[model samples]
Target: METTGTRRSLAWLVGIWALTRVVLLLFVFKVYAFPGPDVTSDVSVIYQGWYEVLRTGTFPLDDVTWQYPPAAALAILSPALVFWLDYTSAFFVLCFAADLVVLLLLLYAGLRSGRTSRGAWVWVVGVPLLGPTVYARYDVMVTGVAVAALLAGARYPRVMGALTAFGAMLKVWPVLLLVAARRRGSWVWAALTAGVLAALFALAMPGAFAFLTFQRDRGTEVESLGALVFHVARQYGWDGQVLLNYGSVEFLGPYVDVVSTAALVLSGLAFGWLLVWRLRARSFHVHTLADGAFVAVLMFVTTSRVISPQYMVWLVGLAAVCLCFRESRMGVPVGLVLVASFVTVLEFPVWFSHVVASDGLGVTLLFLRNGLLILAALLAARELWRSTVPLPTPPPVPTESPRLRETSLPS
Candidate 1:
């Protein structure tokens, strides 16, 4: 049951994780790098907006304000109260430490689902940390919720639903899982998600529902694949206004409408594919959710006119969530995501500049990094499609959950 090497490996892993914590603390505290790095990145601005929100009970109303979903604004503001330090410093480190929360949640989800073996959960921890992208966005927040939701899918549907709903409010993807998913496969899951979301929304504001109305009026940035057409328009010297001030950017080209149409068509197809996948996928495999999420992010990144660096965090976070489940099952895909994460960081900070500088090798590596992510997504999808490993039944919580096996599907 227990071997000396296994014990030694566990000890070493714990030591390395502890070291990671210390190093991250150093990075946050000014020992590993600059003392006062300029707040120039988009994430910095986002944090600034959150800080402002916490300082005063206001969320961004327009592009000038960094308008995010009301629920998300609250989520972002949450850490401010938790850490109680200077916003920037605390924001940076707490976000980093959130990954640790993810790890604990990963284990908790597995344990509740009768998935306590080292093989079942170790990869989730080992692989994501290896990825350089681990340092990226707050996707870990969403992952923590999504995985917890999935793990609760079998026995505690309402609680699962509440988590998923809360995640959807944070970012739109979790909602897709909630709405696009089979209604009865996990009604308790859906109910819980919906309840959690409703509760959060109720607490956010009486007018919080109104904030959701303004998103369609918002702007899309140059980060998406949609920006490619904007670039071509500039190349042709078209003189239409590129973007409007409030939220959405408006670009002009002879084929601008056509490209928009194409983007919609492609995105719709991708969405449709996921819908079909939901229909076919019966297994509650965590990789199933992770693989699908990766595909969704890939579709968005490739087809989106705005691919913000923070977006990578979303995919990476979900990938890490999947790894938690994977380690309990298989190990390889976790390794792939981990490698992709490193390549992602390597390519982004330094390599992105090189590609823009017209270095063909830089472009090659760029594609390579993206390719690794694609490969990882495909690999995980294959396993999800092939492996019908049913979701583990959750034991009862003092709070009741939606029943799993009794769920029925839409015809």
Candidate 2:
């Protein structure tokens, strides 16, 4: 009965949160205004356009901005099934459903673990705090895939691999989850991931590889951590231009390429650190994989050249999973991630103009958000390292031989 009551309480919280998001969508943000500057509006236009292409049996449309793998087309065109609703409405509904799926998975995982409701609370508080941006971006869908993969990872390697592969097709980041799998499980996951990815690429043909070329010419997004360097440089007479490139705020002109390259180098270093962490983890506990995943994702996001507002959805989901374990000592780091999520909303739809202008408030907000992320990454890494590194067992005490024991016994 207590378990039932807890479940009911969780259900009420989730239902209320979902309702608030819907209200925000209809009244506050009006995200269904397709083709507008709001990110989701652009996403809806692109998805609807892609749906038309799919209807014509084409793999990818000719738009250079369509910079995702072929499997993404499945998600992009999925809203077409709701014939009664327009594309914009259908896309919002789909994203909302995906958000709820993630919440359900987190809650179920927490209950199954027989741990405190920390994980469910993380999702419950974190997602809504991120505001409407969670629904406005399809990152929520990718996050759902990630949640399922991690929750199923220990018991079901193949399923984890397949889901990770599906997510990688949508966005490249989900592949990081494979790092947490055991050696044998990792191989199985890797094989299935590669096989599925290859099959999807084969089906899409030439268009499947187009995003690679499209991504090559990309500049540093103005809101990225790297852009903050350039933003500071601008005050010291650095010459550069900020513009909407490829549907994101990007820095162009002198030294932009150099900063972008430097971001890549930093990302490489972060990857190396993750590899070291994986090697040092001698034993895999129930929560080890989830904790490792959270650290890996935090490293990836903090060091990337593109730190979009929606990226918080990924961190929020992963952090929730980490907190599901009773042994996970990541409370401080998870709290930091939640704070960063709130700041992300402030940096985006709230004072995005200030950010674009590189004003004092904007720069400060970015600094706080990015700094919190970096701190969270470091703390999570430390926690995982301490938790996973096996302690040396003391040598067993030598026992007396049987004859010696008999001779020594009181007679």
Candidate 3:
């Protein structure tokens, strides 16, 4: 049933994916040096260290950088599946595999009737925009799970629920995927899966929940939306010092806490807005699940205290899912996110020194990237509301009496 043009376009998508991903694999494997900071150090060093600790039947209890849920141990330890290779190499290979899985899922979803290949195109194009960082971090693996969860949401609500819970266990953001779940089974399955996973991890690992305390003293990263205030203030003699805190470079001096708190409050308000939208929504289409998730994650990521470059992976994944549905009205937001993804790379490994120094180039990149995110969030929120929430009833049109109407017509 596939047309020649469709087949050709599909081939093009596959080819582009292969080429870009091969380049990414090369960069991650150090066949080619990437610019700025070595993003792969997190895998070669931090993740390798945690893999050592996790293999000893425990989490990294002594490391402040171990700030993920207990199930993240599975990700750190996944390299053992490829024991034929060294740890770092194996990890990069697995990340590449996860990226492939995501692409295939998007392709399957996009090729079906009532779906377009825009989602596949988004994944193919957007991932490369973030450069080799796509394969350098475990976030790509988490994103793969998130994409599968969204695509499965329409027909297999329980599967969606289980995947969502598993992904949240991995990175804590995929829980937002359930924001627009219409089936009660989805919620029930999610609760049961999360509870079971939490219990198992707590029993098996020593500091399964310790990540909660690890980030208590963190500050706003230089790339976050709220950090713009400090960036500009630094230009005007703000005394805050940027330092490596809690495993990420952040502002640690005066008013940093205030900005961080404001970020948290913004996240809180975003959540409140989502709840209100859900309550007011009267429409639930197949695409609404993806659209709502896209809006929800966008709001949180934009408002978070740490807008890390890898966070763009999550946005790109959700935006791809949204585009899979022909009826989804998230095209504008998705385009903005793709652009932001490019700017994210520019701000991170491309010119990261500028970002850390809060120089003109760094500030420009962050402002452009974060501003796009803010605009995307606001626009996506608006579209979701207009699409799902019931519109106000219009006034009835007045009609003339039959006698008057007949007389006027005769005249």
lDDT of each: 0.53, 0.81, 0.92
Candidate 2 lDDT trough over 10 residues, lowest sum: 27-36
For candidate 2, what is the lDDT? 0.81
- Total residue pair clashes for candidate 1: 32
lDDT of 3 by residue, 279-391 (tens): 99998998999999999999999999998889999999999999999999999999999999999988889999998899999999999999999999999999999999998
lDDT of 2 by residue, 1-411 (tens): 997998788778777766766765763246344221365556566667777876676655467677777777778777777778887777778887887788778777877745666787788788877766677667888899999999888788878888888888888888888777884765676677767776766775556767877778788987788989887887788878889787678988898889889999989999998888788788678888888889998999998888988899899999998888888888999999999998988888778888888889888999999999999999998988888887778999998899998998997
**Candidate 3 clash pair list:** none
Residue 120 alpha-carbon offset, candidate 3, angstroms: 0.5
Off by over 4 Å in 3: 395-411
Name the best candidate (by lDDT).
Answer: 3
**Where in model 2 is the C-alpha error above 4 Å?**
1-8, 27-37, 59-61, 391-411
Candidates in order: C-alpha RMSD to true structure: 11.8, 5.4, 2.8
